[model samples]
Target: MSIAPKPNPALAELAVLEGEWVIELSNAKFLPGSNSRAQGRVSAEWLDNSALVMRQWQWRRQGDLDHRA
Candidate 1:
């Protein structure tokens, strides 16, 4: 697959994460303990001058674990 190019400076600067991010998970904890922990990734790309698209993926683990996206 062809990879997407990088965004411009103006678009990059404008793409701040100013809003609140609400994440939901299934039987996962934000921290590691007796409960299983989930690792996630956040990626951003410019859709236009005024907006951007963000994506997130979640995976479960106790320690160093492979992530699937």
Candidate 2:
């Protein structure tokens, strides 16, 4: 049998950030383009009994392929 881990009080405050978010960047040097725009999505979730907030993001820059981490 497995027992669920208890939520950490300290991490509780970060729970508010657990949701989908939109990020926008303009004229980024790395993208290197005229009026370039970088649009990305960020999603975070609590893990290890709320001890850590893990995030996975993906982005696309003008004239560039999708990037993820």
**Number of the top lDDT candidate:** 2
User: Which regions of candidate 2 fall more than 4 Å away from where they truly are?
Assistant: 26-36
Candidate 1 is scored at a TM of 0.34
The count of residue-pair clashes in candidate 2 stands at 0
How would you encode candidate 2's per-residue C-alpha lDDT over 1-69 as one tens digit per residue? 988888888777787778889998886677677688899998987776655554789998876789999
Model 1: weakest 10-residue lDDT segment is: 18-27
Steric clash pairs (candidate 1): none
| Tens-digit per-residue lDDT, 1-69, candidate 1 | 966666566665555663335443445355555455454555655564456766545554646575656
Which structure among the candidates has the greatest TM-score? Answer: 2
TM-score of each candidate structure, all chains considered together = 0.34, 0.66
How many clashing residue pairs are found in candidate 1?
0
